[model samples]
Target: MKKPAVLLAVLSFIILSGFTPQTGIKPCYLSLKKAGDLKAGTADRLLADADKTRMLVTEAGEVPITVTEGYRIIYNNKKKAPFVNLIVELSKPENYEQDKKNVLANLSYLNAQTTGMETTGKLLELDYNGYKAYGLSRAGISEGETLGTFVIFPGDNMIIYIYFNNIEPAKGHFKNAAEYQGYRNDFIGQYTAHLAKCK
Candidate 1:
């Protein structure tokens, strides 16, 4: 398959798998109830707004998963809520390595494709639920004035990406660097809890 096609396939797999990864346990679909119950207040607040479906259409094709949904969150007293969408897929890393060389290569390609990028953090390899994964931070790539993160969890046959962005508020984005990192850490902690509860 072409590079893009293969990428899409891998992405599709990640999206289809939900948070269960490819472990022995069955994967669970995400929902407003599950998200709202999470100790992560921000996450609960975000998902509390809606319980809807999403269309995962890619050049490779589409994955039919009705549980996918979107939500809006009001941050820093902003009146306009940013629309958020979640896509889940299930697939394995065809060339995953201990040092994450494959992921680094892919990140390089993504960085090149990105324009107006202000900054990007180093890619860190970490484990989630006994599964090897990679996480990175970035900013200034979006022209829509969005600030957020991108995380990838590479599993045996499940690669999950969490794309989160918030529209720039009138007062500006996060209060400061510390505030941003705090939110990011909270998000990761809550997300891990949600995944555990789902299974």
Candidate 2:
């Protein structure tokens, strides 16, 4: 497979892993009741609103159980309240080394990708998922790491990481960064579970 295709596959699996069995589909996300329940139109509408953009979800693609692929929705679903996720696929790192490297690069890229980027504090290094992890927090968000992080896998081919946090201006986007963190927490937890299954 081509590199882009592989990356797309990786992205899809990681997103889909968050859903539970009762979710109707194999990997459907639970809706936020407060958000007036999750409607198909909601995801579409959120994608349309740039000003209300505290989160985003785009389609990745999946072939289902046999081997999912194509285009599917990946976004930060806050309507269901806390714990949003990517669109689909839901795969995690089986190879620890590569996962770490790929993940770190993604986080670093986000600093460059997002608008008005300001990085504060030191880049923290630790260990998680059997790989050395490094977390970089933007300066203004209190004491904890609040921007993005990367998990370096064993080699250099694959790296697993997630980028999130409040970073919102208290009033707009997400209610606060902590709310964003809830989505991050969900993404990581489901991804970790997927990794266990892959192993």
Candidate 3:
């Protein structure tokens, strides 16, 4: 289908639904970007080729899901150390808050995957972009630091996962809990504002 037609259908669905963001402003619907426009890594050296970024839109667990559009940003010139990756995945789900327990469990699985790290603080919960989310902080037992923020955007039917970790094994350090929280707030705020402008 053409972009405009898909967009029209999406917008109609959202506007007609009773769900609304916390601000009570409904976002004009649009894809994150056409796949061709995405560029990863520094201009000097390419890390991820835009043409290779592929996510199939399909049904999962009886929910009709489609990955309308999305993008990925990879930091550190593709090196695994001190890694950071920001990904935006916009999808349309059959129902809001569907299989919420399973969703949370998936996030918990990621938390368990971290190795050689000690919990630095309690799990941080948030009401981000009209959705319930949480974050976790951990420090390396003998090397690096890490912070992971998981956001489930119910209104938008999107899940944004941010993982920030120190690349330097011996020199890595995670700032205070407040600093991580600030980062989360800023990201969610900017994304919500941008969505409001979509059309």
Candidate 4:
């Protein structure tokens, strides 16, 4: 129930997990913010996650999928190898009604032309703190060489949006993805394990 306890639990999870990130280092934190931020308390809920992940038709023949994931690593297949670590995916179809409708429609149209690309319907998912997350992406789309990715943190007090390439594009500081597992565990999955919620 306490933040410290939660922080410990998250650290334990990361360390105990069999698979280690590339860095071989584990993060330790109950929430995204540090102790000071937790004690201060901040506003919660900015743009509430979409009520639903549905279908919408887009102008182009391409159908874009919308979804979320806990501690997910989106990699582009075309590049050299590991692809890029997506921080914040802009134009994530943030529009509520419009985005939902367009995403659904695009899915159908794309399905007809491509195979193995059907919306499996919540294929990979994670729901925590009344917040449900899904992930959306395609294989061939190019991510360019991210060579970028520093810190992927939360905005406001509600969401953790990862944003890289702040000053430059395609070229930015690199944040070892392996080091963030601890932060992911505590922040994501089930409940607010580390940070103290507003009283």
Candidate 5:
């Protein structure tokens, strides 16, 4: 199969197995009730907003590259809310080691992708419900900066990226850096635990 075709297949598997709405089965990602203080937004709305800002090539010839947004949880569900976005991307290489290296490279590329934002702090290795994952931090250069924690888990032929960000910290939802970190960890733990149960 072509690379795009393979990617589509893997993405289809992920969506059907985890994100799709089905009778009696809860989704693997975070939900409105599970988020507690955070409010929920539809993935379709998030994708639409993203489409306005960036062009996403969904198809190439006969094959389609599916970009699935799992759960979009935010503070107050406002237009400009502190949010957590979950997205899955296809791994370029078939080999696990090469794919892992590519994931790290992609994380580094984030620093240069945006003019005012930079990926900062050390990349930490983590265990998410028995799956190996990596987490990195990001910050905006300007004042009233955005603080974010990005985590990725490499799967069979896909990588799951979860980004947690606070766009406006002065609102005082999180008292300190440690409080924000705790919330991020709890959110990740809940998500991974749900996935494990589904499996």
Candidate 6:
């Protein structure tokens, strides 16, 4: 299947029953550009791409989920492909709390959805600035290239997903697991700090 299809399949599993229609004032999209050494794409372009992706996923008929409110931003380096991608999905406050409590269960469900093309590493439990978080490292099964780390955490009424991919490993961002962990941690800290200012 295509990359979007594959991504939708995985996201379908992660968000199938996790989001509910929320009423009242919607959260505003964060105005963030530079986080650590990463720079983001234009807000309009990122939002348009996210909307297109959502429409495609909804029309695919593979999943019965609809992302009513969210934002997707691609953080790039000098490379063409994004080095890190951020997805902020809003949910009801109650659902957010529940999801936070059941993060492990959710991660297990996500792990089961991984296909033969991808191999997932051990789940890394994290305390992201006092917010409960989890990280899963994934790579291609054949090439063994570092795909990225999927770092998940809960916000007030939203779920934050940070996909940290070192597309330009030749630039010496990270060479091994330990180095990757350090790099991801630094990025997460900087990114979350930016998020703290978001309303």
Q: Which candidate should be chosen as best, given TM-score against the real structure?
A: 6
Lowest lDDT sum, 10 consecutive residues, model 5, at 52-61
Q: How big is the positional error of residue 18 in model 2, measured in Å on the Cα after superposition? A: 36
Per-residue lDDT for 15-48 in model 3, tens only? 9775763431132322232111222343122233
Measured by lDDT, the strongest candidate is 6
How big is the positional error of residue 123 in model 3, measured in Å on the Cα after superposition?
4.3
Model 2, which residues run further than 4 Å from truth? Answer: 1-73, 80-122, 139-146, 154-156, 165-186
What is the alpha-carbon lDDT for the whole of candidate 4? 0.33
- Write one digit per residue (lDDT tens) for candidate 5, span 52-104: 11222211212222332223444442344655666544332334355445555
lDDT by residue (1-199, candidate 6, tens digit) is 9999999999998797578644522344346777666688864322433431121121222232233356677877654457677776655554555444454454545555555323354466656555545755553322334444454554445566677664545654456656666766776776666555554
TM for every model, in the order presented, reads: 0.45, 0.33, 0.44, 0.26, 0.54, 0.58
C-alpha RMSD of each candidate structure in angstroms: 14.7, 15.2, 11.4, 17.6, 11.7, 14.9
Q: Model 3 segments beyond 4 Å from truth?
A: 1-69, 74-84, 112-123, 128-131, 139-146, 169-185, 192-199
After superposition, the stretches of candidate 5 with alpha carbons farther than 4 Å from their true spots are 1-33, 45-80, 91-99, 108-122, 138-146, 154-156, 170-172
Clashes of 2: 48
Query: What does the lDDT read for residue 115 in candidate 5?
Result: 44
Off by over 4 Å in 6: 1-29, 44-66, 98-104, 112-122, 138-146, 149-153, 166-172, 197-199
- Report the lDDT tens digits of candidate 1 across residue range 1-199: 8999999999998888876633321234233222222221132223523433333432334432222222222222233333223333333234233213333455444544455443443444445454443444444323433444344443333334554454454533355445544454545455556566665
Which portions of model 1 show Cα errors greater than 4 Å?
1-29, 32-80, 83-85, 92-104, 111-121, 125-133, 139-149, 154-156, 171-173
Candidate 3 or 5, higher TM-score?
A: 5
For lDDT, candidate 1 versus 6, the one ahead is 6
Clash tally for model 4: 16
Candidates 5 and 6 compared: the better one by TM-score is 6
Question: Per-residue lDDT for 1-199 in model 4, tens only?
Answer: 8999999999899887856623211122122333211121222222337533334454464444333322323322222223233222222325434443454354345344443321344222335555443332222222423212122222221223321111122432223333222223333442233322431
Worst 10 residues of 2 by lDDT: 62-71
Worst 10 residues of 1 by lDDT: 36-45
